[model samples]
Target chain A: MSLDFLAGFTIFMLALIMVVSMVPGLLAGLESSGIDYDAVAYRTGVILVEDPGWPVYPPWEMNDEVHKDEIERIGLAVSKDTPNILLSTKVETFFNDSFFTPDDYRNLAIFGDIPYSYHFSLRSLDGVTYNEETGDPLPPGYGYIRRVVKIKEPGVAVINGTTFAPQYTSLSSNQEFIVRLDFGQLLDPSVGAAYRIDPRTEPVNVTITNFGAYLNMTEPSTNATLRTVTFWKKDPTRPIPQFTRIPFAYGTTDSSLYTLTIDGNPYDLTPDTKVFDNDNISLVLKPAATSLFTLDQNSILDIRFNFGDTPSQTNITGIHHYDYNSTNVTLPDLQTGVLEVAVW
Target chain B: MVNDAGQLYTMEGVAAGVIMLLTVYIVISTTSIYTPGDTHIPDMQLEQLGSDVLAMMDTPDTNGTKSALETFVNADDDAGFESMFLSYCNAKASGAADDLHMSANVTYRDGNLIKEHQFLAPDNTWTGRESAVRVTRWVQLDSQPGRTTYAGARAQAVLVEVLLWRA
Candidate 1:
């Protein structure tokens, strides 16, 4: 009889406690406002803008007829054409990923729903990138249209094409998860929102480590009397094996350094070498140091050579240079497979 | 009143059981979510655009002073080409297009086209873009057409090789 009485009392106490707990929770649930979360679009990208006017390397060909044809090919007017540089490149990057997650599921939900449209406009050449609308300046080049590229986990992400990452989270669904949105608007049907690097956008610091001109400056040679012999060292990261020691891309400044030895004599490169990594090559220059070539009588000579990301990349800087001295300039022996030597 | 409380508790148990069953059914139906499938779109659209770009590979003729490589690039065709290229980028960037690609390699000599060959494009299986071209302001893109998202093969790529020279 005593055991039964104690059990009943214990049950009564438990029931009373449960009722007390439920009262506050029920009231709170009734009064609580549902989650009002920000949308993924607002948190991910800036508002859409018109064409960013990313740069383009004007088409160029050496032949008059071919050049004319190339102009027609790019759909530009011959007389109105400006010197556009092209940087050819053989770049290979694979997007390899093994992990898929809840966020990926969310993309299936979000990306399909949002209606995205792209617009672009021209920017001034002085690197003044303006938003096509309102005429406001964009973040130097392409601004952050999206916050995250590929989402790795909740509230964290990776930048596409680049390794850098920024803090990000999805405001939609209020789930406090990572957001993945790509805002890199492609060039017009043929271009991307970001700069369109053809053979033109290469580092211009490429030097002819071993370039010797067989001119009247020293002694007349079978090579062009006013002939310029210049050799550019292939960058370690050159895109093509046929061009560089290593078939890969090197850092901008380091690879741009061109070690040029004129007849075994090294010469630091000057801007006038008409050396820009691009598809088109045409420029006249005044020599900085006339070690192997004399600039007195035939001071001006048209020189054309291209050094870039083996396949493409012209605006690159710090190509290898050569050692220039008072005495005879010597050049290192390079495979002259593409070079055709002749004198006028 | 005692009987009423017993029945209330029983109702909650039944409701929870139904929810559990529903959750299992939903998961089974959505399992195909992670696996990607093809859109299988036709090739006519891509081919037309490809031909137009290649056909415009016009350049200037031989002048002792001009670089044949530079001269061969089209002049008036630039705006049109850029428009096309920009649109391509936009479509891919916007994820409205698929990531199909193609390209070609060429060697320039004596202001003339010499050796030319078709190139493989970047794929999910590869690390880098094959037959890619680096342009100004646009960085570099693969020579082959780029990719856009699709449930299946909504896009296709046609390989082409053209030796651009003055006509």
Candidate 2:
């Protein structure tokens, strides 16, 4: 009987030892290691603000749904040179929850062994909500960081009737209004990246107002038929500089790339459309289209607006240089914003 | 004899139980309960926020104009600098501002000695014991004319140190 009791007792002792050995492992969840949450938050802030992020060429922000997997990191700053100055496109992409999954944010942004829940928010000083959140509801005790940032808004070239009326009527009815973007002057190294007009990333806006003033009023009707708008690129670095029409998928209307609005109605650049005078002609060329153009810093991008009618509709002509002429283009001042990141 | 043997077994069991209990007690006690000192997370967070606000202020909004930080530091406008810094730190996405207090000092090298000018004084509620974080920025000044705090009037780089804490 004693021997049997001893065997049972030994078994119980062994079992107890085993349970004791596993206690630390079980308690591991209860007591986390000295990994600082705030340190993780600070690191994340630095990643988003200072670094330009992975795949600098093409930029991670350019990745679409299909190419989403290729993007390793999401950074908002325009470039490493301009810290705390975020690019609007990058900001949009980073906050787009539909494009990026939670796992993607975990792996790409708050990289840690243990997956962390995060809340990121950016509010512009102009009271615009650029982005609100990227994750679940923030818990009580979470790693938090707040950064003050300035957002570099895209510049618009406004060619009103007052500024270009004389030049428009100067040439006879070939009917082409050329708005030239000198990339060399726009991308001058002396100009800081925060304020530089980089066509590769920023949308090019050309808004012509008071169209009636430029119309062929000499013709009985004040309305003019806009034939087709075409993009032409010329590389000044080449020995022979000549403008060549850019080959684009003009057949399909990609509003993401470029949008042409005549009096507020969207229309395809190709084919014939009637442009009424006393209306607005706004053309916004998105960065995606600019990237597809394959133009470099020395290349001059011409946005030619062609008007066609049997007797020639409009007398608008000559190239309008979209430079720092404040009267021609209105560059909005950089607005301040606050970006907060919380991780747990 | 059987009774004696039963008594010995019971005593042995009691001894074993005591040994097991002691082992667990020692193990649990020795397992270090991590103190906050090991991870200065709060301090780190505060430092980063302060630094970011200062750095952002130093950055020019456009290519041509002077930075807000330079203008504030050059003019030695304590109230202006304090208000700006607080606003930048306090403004939140929720449209509600945070409650953060700060004191600032400008440090510049004056010949052989390093001089510190009291840029901003703490408010009346400030106590010496609050856990505060220090953040600094380097501001280059064209000249120190009409300022008796620092020695040389020539162009010099000054360090703007700000001590920030939560109220």
Best by TM-score: 2
Query: What DockQ does candidate 2 have relative to the true complex?
Result: 0.39
Chain A of candidate 2 compared with the true chain A, TM-score: 0.87
**Would you list the C-alpha lDDT of every candidate in the order shown?**
0.23, 0.81
Q: DockQ for every model, please.
A: 0.03, 0.39
lDDT of 1 at A308: 23
TM-scores for all candidates: the values are: 0.20, 0.85
After superposing candidate 2 on the true structure, give the runs of residues whose Cα lies further than 4 Å from its correct spot: A1-39, A167-173, A217-221, A310-313, B1-34, B144-153
Report fnat for all candidates as fractions from 0 to 1: 0.00, 0.35
lDDT of 2 by residue, A181-257 (tens): 99999998888888888888888999988887787766756878877889999999999999999998865678889
Model 1 quality (TM-score): 0.20
